[model samples]
Target: MYDPAYGATDADLITFMGEEVREESAALGRRWFLVAELAGRRFPEMVGRQMYCADSISSVAAEISPVLNISHSRAVWQVETAITLRDRHPQVFKRLCRGLIDYRMVSMIVARTDNVADDVMVELDEAMAGRVEKWMKLSKNKLRDRIDLFIAEFDPAAVRVPPDADKHRYIDIDPGDTAGTAFVSGRLHAEDGAALDQRLDALADTVCSNDPRTKSQRRADACGPLARGEATLACQCGLDDCPARANRAAANAAVIHVLAEQGTIAGTSDKPGYLPGFGVLPAQSVRNLLPAAQTKPVTVPTADTAAQTGYRPNATLTEFLRWRDLTCRWPGCDKPVQRCDIDHTVPWPYGPTHPSNTKHYCRIHHITKTFNTGAGGFTDEQLPDGTIVLTAPTGHTYRSQAHGASMFPALRQPTGTVETTPLPPESPDRIAMMPRRRQTREQDRRERIATERRKRTEIITEQQRQHQAWLAATYEPPPF
Candidate 1:
């Protein structure tokens, strides 16, 4: 695989591959524009890896990127410029180029190319052409923003607002305001309201003072108490001699002092306005507390999934949630198993149930891994650092590095000067080619749109089936 004649490094491979693709395009009477799409699909692992490990375009080209072709054609000239300028302030260019590439692929994928109605297909092609024009002329940041705006515009089911209903109206209970009858039956004054606002503001200020402690820090803090409590419960004679117990005691004392300073409770009430242990209290009182009311809507999944998977008649939902969370205990990827089908490392039906017996990946990655099995999709192994080591299908093993360590490295500007060679002015031959180029681009854009329409039709059909399944399984149409 590393034969020098074929080009040894990743970059060499990319260049060679790109040349081959260009040749193929020419031989087949295809335009060079489709080469980008082919590159993205054929080398997704390489592309994805570079994106994960790169900081700037210059650094990526030097250390990771696998691109090969460069041109000054209308369709890909801007892209070529962005890539070639990798050595000159690369981060900005990399971001812009990647954004353009990502949206182009995503829009095509999400639009589903085959079945869109004729008029809709025409409109989509027009929109794609406009986006490409912006890409050709705009700065990287502007391009990124435009791509984001475009995605937002086409995202399905984005606005799910329900119709306004009488029951949805807000109810005001302020005693001074003309509203519903008060439950407390107390006289509300301006000062009292002001006082309440002040207290809430203070509480918010204290709670939101700094960023929340990360999961690791919180776990470390919890471990100290847990270890000490376990020791004490075990009645270990070492408890009296243990430094851990002493530290725990000192921490508790400090907590008590902080609680005393901060007001642990409000004034007690017989018929008093508020109860003692309410409102702005000491930090200790609320230290381990989660607010009873949460702002974010909780997605309580239906319990039917496990039942559908052929569980017992009376299975509790708690088990399903636990199983879902446990599917990928590999730190960052906590995808619910209900949404992901299981992948048996040893191949299920033949493999037994064990912790090491299975792993889970989403549909796309699962298929990709299967496709790249010869290259090295992923393998199960635990690293010395307690992180799981999964070999990618590309024959590269990526251990679960510190959550942040796997990210692309910082960008480095190119030290050498980039030669600025302006293109020669267009001749009559080049001018004559302009109309042909425009026509080719328009045709390619139309083809892509057509492809997207088909994909969308397939998706819509799938959605319809899912809807029907839902209706049949859980819903009963009213006496039709």
Candidate 2:
């Protein structure tokens, strides 16, 4: 059914690939147009709405999710891109439709200008559209820098600000596919990560050179003693008086949390135990953790214990909710429960602070609900069994059940019913009372961009001075 490319020369193949890419770009542009149309149809009155704000909610992504077989979050991003290109960057969209610019370039331009004000966006669109097609060979970082340069020149206040890296630092451990092993990973501050790497090397070297383990194996093993705060790793050469062995004071043990059934810990049952961030542990692995484990009994919530008269739940209730929900209760959100806030499904004053009326929401979603609830926003309801029903503004409902319910059936037990009073009429002017930054977004962006540009200028000036000094040191006058 297809012609073979085996006989084609390398040059012919290259030309064919280039043509295919152009055709694909044009097709993707048409697809984006359809996506924009779908979003419009779903929310015809979205003209004045802020589609990309934290408080904004859209069900168009949910509709697209099933059709595209992609995650809701990915679909949401696609919708945003489509709308941005079609409405905010008409000239860029035209270039895209003509296959002069690829989708990747379009995506980058869209993301870079996300915080741009409407008045500035029109100019950015026109400027970028005329130049981006010529940037097909630029590396990703180079392209990003170029886009930022344009933004900095046109509207310094609209340049995208870098996030605080420290706030986003994280560590993750995942169970390996192979039995009885786990993968450890993390992001750390540059100096800290480098120090850790050096420490691991030092610890690994403490073992005798004659030790049979490979360098990498020794380094991996060194992590255990390092985590326990040990100063040195014991030599394994089996010499009676090894020089590397030292009689040192014992360091404090590292603490970790592991959840398991009594039977599993006692070796009477083979049921796998759950490790919060890392997935299921084999029965043997659970038993292995018992040696250094400090067991904490998690009490199951009963009707009486689950209901709270005050706004805050007791520690017991809090623990129960964390174990039950496992992650943020917002549909498709996977933020761990440890990092989430226990929010009342129905506002506290109108409803009792009971398990049945509360669920986990990460900080972002918590604020999203706080500012975007009422006649034109999302609604949240909870069933007695810790199941949440979230209804979007477009009237599409998404259901999320407690993730831990499958592991612990007791979590599904109903808490006592609480009567909820009708909420007070929402003020039409409430939008005006929403929180505002001390400095406006534009002001903040401007300051950040100015600081960045100043630093770059300083660096360039220093480099030029260094170059002039080097040339002066090497100078020799020509003899007449």
Candidate 3:
């Protein structure tokens, strides 16, 4: 038997992998085409329905979900994507069949351009078909920007804004694999999450430094006191004069930083505001925050004023970077600037403290960039317009542009030019100063699991004892 891959070179293998991806994309396009055809057959049955043909489409999706091994909602979404692509964006659908674009990108295109008028859709389809093939390497945010730019330019009314997530806030507690444990998760408004996080941090810090529990553990324990409306968490240290307990004060107020255009702050422009850790805020939501917010006018940096001689950026430059970078500049990393470190791309003194030479990187990635450099390590390069090009040890390169700049084009303006000297040679004996954990990850996990299980068991026992007492008190003989 012949095995073509037996003697394949790395380059050959890479090419083959890309070919496989293209084929998979083409197959998915064909599947969507068939789904659209099947759905078209049900159009007559869907006519003049109470919900404007929603029921018939739902029935089709319900029937397809089982056969496709997908959820009913997912099936319905796929059906909509298929119909939109087949009917409204036929040219783009043709490209999908040719493996020029994948289904995920197609789905995004369909969703963002969904509100385009029937006549306008034809033009958009033709325009997008000509451009989408070149967008293969774009990041998710950049891809959305590309799609949106066209939609905004062609049909401003058709541009789709993300739905207000606050309307769908919910919390869920699911039983864990261990009998007595549960996992808590939820979605909250940005302000609520910020306030809760601040309160938890404040409570967690009330315990003395001598407490045995890790910071994370203390934070988890703090939740109990917070729920009970307590002002402080009890210190675990045995010392009678525990300084943390003595110095504790009420939780500090949570301050949420939002960046918006002056027009947006007023009632004039509806441009959305950027919430540092969360995401984009609708214009109305931004205005709603103004009542509780301490408004400060931040100077947007220009090319001339972007550079400073000091190690740290000035407030103006910092604010500009926040608006420009929005999140950690690492490819595929979306940690917001609120939780990120301002990193010097070319390493400080050698490179001036300037926007062109700096970008946001979360602590982990900042350490990774600092420690991992030179041969067999990741390399980073930044462009004047806040684009970062990262090369991996594997030699694969990823280019990420400033996310905020895509949403607000003004942020794309280039900053001041800075002269940089070459980085000094690495020292052979210098050790990387990475943070070490007190406990191994496995030990920490085991401890957490044990604590949760014990707590849950205690809660169940208390509930059972109360139930028994109620039964004993209410017991009465039947009057038969």
Candidate 4:
């Protein structure tokens, strides 16, 4: 709170100024904690209005987004991270409050330890004691390295990555300050990077005689035509063993996995199409990704939907299960289905290869389930509609429902809790004729609002119906 006037030549001015900045940062952290506390405290008011937990949290996101001029996702992250900082690392939270460390330094610790076991976190808290200042002084990467060392020493599993870490890759499109464009960034495996480098470099040099764009700009420009299907993709480096060395048709290179309806794919409807791993893509993008998106004929099984005798599924069945689960069926893991082990809810041979009996799970969660299932740690039960409820060792159960925009967006989740009340016929209509006319903006907004509610409700209703039918058929009620 020191406001030094222009001519103040205090001997310790530099030190004092630095101290002020740190103090202010600590104050900011404390303020953020208060804000998150407010959100939790206000939850009841929103829920009392019959809003689902997800919607209530979205209220928090909406409130903070414009106030901070940040994206809703970023706003939600700030709130979630603050809550985790306090819940998982109270000592570090205190350090943040006292200005002993800045939020980013605390965030480094949070990232490394959030997914770790609770007991491991307690050990981490003990190990990190009295070192807050040291961590704060180090560069971010150095601090992360220190945290990694601690995780390795205390709980080696805490730093463990999936066996398929090489498959871990993603692209991020960051919107830049100057409008209409985004900075596309991504990480690829070494071989893939080398392949992409050759392809991009070749494209960049193609027009070198007249192109005045910078190398980075040229590469960026070159990616557009390839994605939009205007240009081809191939390894021009002539490297024999290069990953992209094999020639692929332009369409095949940009082929994306989508589960769009025949109507949506045919341009008859504009409902956003579902892309596995990625949620929904605009209709045009879906159409462009696979213009001739053919619908594979699905056999209408005479037997139960969940019934099959084989242990391993065939190609068609595999695709069905992948798109069916979308991600790992573990309570909160979102590992893409492509990277999961299709696991049986009921042990194999006993469970059968039916659709109902199996779900996808990442390796870690699959291992977790292997040990967790049966008599002790956890139990996985699949509902009639493929929603899974995990019964924990503590007896508290959690549900993981299949959700996507494909015909059934009924998997929308309400974080922290799942409200199972079916969404009523509250709207006269939820759709409008497209090219997305200007007249129905209000209706579109209303539909989006109802969507989250309806999805959760539908799943809940299905769960209730299945449970009720089971009880009626099997469990006999006493004369109480």
- lDDT by residue (tens digit), candidate 3, 1-480: 224668877788788888988999999999899889877986674453313222445545644553464644577677877887888999999999888899778877887776666778888889989999898789899999999899867776566645557767998765455432346789998899999999999888888789888888888878756765677877888788888777654554455577788899988999888766556677887897776478887565667777788999987788888878888876656667888999998888999899899889866567656765677556888888888888765466777799988777778777766799988898853322444446543356456545544554566578789999999999998999
**Full-model lDDT for every candidate:** 0.34, 0.76, 0.75, 0.61
Best by lDDT: 2
- lDDT for each residue of candidate 2 in 1-480, tens digit (9 for 90 to 100): 123456777777787888888989999899889889877775654433342334222456644553464545677788878988988999999888888889779889988886666788888889988899888789999999999999878866566656667878988877677655678988899999999999999888887667778889889888878998987776677887776776433498776666677888888998887777666778898897786678888777677667678899888888888888888877777678888899998898798888899889876567666666776577888988888887776577787888876676777788777789999888876554554446543356567656755555666578789999999999999999
Q: Is candidate 3 or candidate 4 better by lDDT?
A: 3
RMSD of each: 25.6, 6.8, 25.0, 23.8
Give the 10-residue window scoring lowest on summed lDDT in candidate 1: 407-416
Displacement of the residue 364 alpha carbon in candidate 2, Å: 2.4
Instruction: Tell me model 2's lDDT, rounded to 2 decimals.
Output: 0.76
List TM-scores for all candidates, in order.
0.25, 0.67, 0.43, 0.46
Report the C-alpha lDDT of model 1 over 222-255, residue by residue, as the tens digit.
4323333321111123434543334222123111
In model 2, pairs of residues that clash are none
Q: What ranking emerges by TM-score with the best candidate at the front?
A: 2, 4, 3, 1
Strongest candidate by TM-score: 2
